[model samples]
Target chain A: MGDNMSELLNVKNLKTYFFTKYGTVKAVDGVSFKVDKGETFGIVGESGCGKSITALSIMRLVPDPPGRIVGGEIVLEGEDILKISDNEMRKVRGKKISMILQDPMTSLNPVFTIGIQLEEAIKIHQGLKGRSLRERAIELLEMVQISSAAVRYKNWPHQLSGGMRQRVIGAISVSSEPRLLIADEPTTALDATIQVQFLRLLRELQEKTGVGLVFITHDFGIIARMCQRAAVMYAGRIVETGSVRDLFDNPSHPYTAALMRSLPKLEEKVERLASIEGQPPPLNDDIQGCRFAERCTVAEHQCRLSYPDETEISDGHFVSCWKF
Target chain B: MQRYIVIRFIQTVITLLILSIVIFTLVRMSGDPVLLMLPETATEEDYELMKSQLGLNKPVYQQYLIFLFDAVKGDFGKSIRTRKPVILSIKETLPNSIKLVTVAFVIGFALSIPLGIVAAVKKGTVWDNMARVVTGLGQSIPTFWVGLMLLQIFVVWLRILPASGMDTWQHYVMPATCLGIFLMSGVARLLRSSMLDVLDSEFVKMARIKGVRESVVIWKHALRNSLLSVVSFGGMYIAIMVTGAILVETVFAWPGFGRLAYAAIVNQDFPLIQGVVLTAGAVVMSANFFTDILYAYLDPRIRVQV
Candidate 1:
């Protein structure tokens, strides 16, 4: 774990559930992680593995009626945000911690110009208005490396290319210099070339602002390149957590090992890529044993009887598995 | 943008031209206007003189050509029953219809927008169900029945309002409410579904993530997008209110364009009928044209394409 003094975000045993008509979906169950200032904490998982839900939980943005954070302590800069009133929570959202969502195409309001959207965040958090607000918005655009910032400001979201819109979204997220920024699959919709450029921009922005980032994505390559510390999740739980280097070199959990093996290796000439067999168990049903026990190879009877506890294998590496 | 407007204008002209042809043919087919003009005691000579004088003795195609030529110059001929110019009759009664429709539209829009937004935001709550039931009843109930019931309650029972005529603002209350109820229900239902879709959209989620006040999120962000469908439907509804309020007009005894058209049709007044139908068609087309322009303004994607 990162030192307490430098920690910017600490999420402890967060459980976010969805109460549908049929049953309760334990989407994010007992997940915990921490992010330090100027550090990137990567959350890597497949679709429906609660990576996105965990981020939404941090922002208190889980859609209600069906979804709710049932149990959680989201401590940000020594304060537990879960205990705050909605008004105060609203203040915490943009000013203290902001989020950049996936799909730049749909992330921005189509009716508004990019400048107005950017200026909106600035106005709300920084309290700048009139000429100064406009200038600051243009400056933020320039900082995001959008050329012809003054003219582009007038362009709507539809007028910009996918990459440019993502940049604008990034600019909006960091406009307030938030202590933490949760980027939920921000580049999934971008073209491959644009994806590389966007990741680089994120890194540069983090270095400049020294803001902690909770980077959420399914791509291992992104986790390797962008994250300092990474957590592998499966069935709404963190299966493993360690330094990115340690995770890549020595995957502790069976699910983590399988995911690593499934990634196409450039050095190996193989006809078929490795794939994990079987789907994740339905979340609505209560499971007594380890959630991944069904798909995990070398699982003993004990693995199916009860969930395993996290065991530290190295100084900062931890894994939850019967073998550990 | 200028080009787009010019295109829409041309389209409106074409639409009105087609409508005029339909109205001309349909009105002429409805028993001869000459017979209606002549008294029962008049001889055949009287009918023949009236027919030739009114140019009904000409071939159908030739009569249409003359009608078209005169119509292009803004002349719709004189009414068979009243001997007043058809255009003048419309000019007189059109303002009353405009007033009623405007009042109805304002009330309907004012009530429906908030109702729809509240219903959608608090979906599955008591407010949502209440909105649903109210709008459902508004849509399902017959307009004339609603008007008569309102008259019975407000005028006969409560004695708070006038029963008929456009004599006072009190007379307008029941009629406008009756007309506006249908519009309100339709727009509210449309806006509710639209708000539902928009509330679930990524932009709305992003707005909330920005820590915008919940009110701002619902009112400014969600409301703007949801209003697109409402504006389109409301525009068409306004056209309907202008020309299709005959039943309400009859029930309330309001001397509007709809009532004028009803009387012209009953009297088999060809020129007046043509005038009314053509005018109604023009109103409908122009409403649609303006709606398209407003739609473009509200949605940038459409503006770019145009």
Candidate 2:
């Protein structure tokens, strides 16, 4: 975690399946990515596009019975996490890489105070005790710019405003100062003003603590604001990856192109925002060709028959469509 | 939280009033305790005199009002069957009933939390499936039948325990097993669903991704959240055991109020029946009232959602 050349977090060929009554739903299939030190990496896609599922797989937070991580490798700092025991995995969870969930509303325990929950995470990770723990929790609260940290720190989750709760969640995540922070749709539930404040605060924190961040979201505006690099997912695969600027300015994949166009631009007054037609493919579909082929603007005969492999278009830019 | 408490208290009071009216009316309607108390030589005049003295000759509403009044003053009428103070009768035997119910509650809570957790955590695994089957059986079978079967096995055949009475810890095994079986299964099934739901919550997943200890995740985040449902069932079960204890108390002939009240009811003993029924109403009401306060205490959302 302290060293530079060493990868902070590396995931390879991750596959998570849900064995339901109907069939095995491949929620996350053959996904791979890496988060470097102190940089914000974002995964952007439409709903049910496996963006969130990829994050869940990385955390191994999949529910058992129906949900299982069938195959994959989760390499965290030279160690294969998937090979580790559940007991050991739990020990590594809070101390190494902490996660902030999608909805701050349901993420905190209803019974506990924000301070108590934050302290619980701190106590377990830092082994802080008694008065020291309280002080540490207050310090963490203040770090997130929560006003009256001393007073509001003692209040329960419901007592605090929604933005304040998200801030408390941020405080808890950074409490241990882990090298990696997995923020799954961290600002989705917040208003635009709060969302901007939160994202800016997160970027500041990442820089200050030098913690790598994995931001998962369906909102491209969020990716544009927060991420240095972005990966575009469609159906259950990473279809494109590059700098956020590159992806936004020149989206190679047709789906990515459609997504960029669909988002309303603040600079221009257009007749209408371009929209991608048709719903997401069914969970059970084999997806022999490109998943976006049905909605792709330039769908060739080959695009409907076989899935085009990822072709590197630039130094780091990668796109999956078989186009120039 | 304050609003929730006020509403819950009002609801509990209304429930108790309705329960009081129904029990008071029915106990008197069963007829004269003296008819079953006296011999065939005792004429209709004898019954009339006894009914008049006991206030049974008055309207049912009047009897209920007097009973509710005396109940607040700690003046439960004398037991017609035993010819002793009703309060003394309850005082002498209520400890036995409390001890039994307490022991049974501890056992049921202990067994059910783990059973429910295992069922939820494992889902379709053998242990989970086995728990589901066991709970289903528990819900379908009567507590008395379960008690009888346990008695036959543990006391009747093996002689490992005494089958009846509140005399020794050994004597309690059959009765506690009987009382605990139904609740344990019902609570376990409830906890299973609740645990699964809690396990899926963002907090639980957040705990997992933190690399927090499994025990910590459960006890702090997942288990506490899961216990909210258990709190609800806890309130309901207290009321159930209050009523169920009467039957169990009489079955074992533990000399508790249950047997005395049952006998009085059979004989139509107005004083004793009124006392026991009213006391039972208070216990159930207070239990429900306390549980509502606890619900508000445990979850602030209960207040917010209201």
Candidate number of the best DockQ: 1
Cα lDDT of model 1 by residue, B1-306, tens digit: 777778878988998888888888887777777776778999988888888988889898899999999987879989878889999999989889889888888888889989999999999999999999999999999899999899889888999998888888887898899888988998999999999999999999999888889999999899998888777775678676864488889889898999998998888788888888888777778888898888888888786574
Strongest candidate by TM-score = 1
In candidate 1, residue A20 scores what lDDT?
96
**Tens digit per residue, CA lDDT, model 2, A193-305:** 99999999998898889998999998888898889898998888888999998899889998899888888878999998888888878767777888888988799989889
Q: How far is candidate 2 from the true structure (C-alpha RMSD, Å)?
A: 3.3
lDDT of 2 by residue, B1-306 (tens): 777778888888788778777876776577656676678898889888887887878887787798777876878777666778888877777677778888889888898988998898888789999999999998889776776677778878988987667777888877777778778998999999999899888877766766677777776687778888888767689878876676776666656656666776787667777777777777768887887677777877776766
Candidate with the greatest lDDT versus the true structure: 1
The CAPRI category of model 2 is medium
C-alpha TM-scores of all predictions: 0.96, 0.90
Off by over 4 Å in 1: B29-62
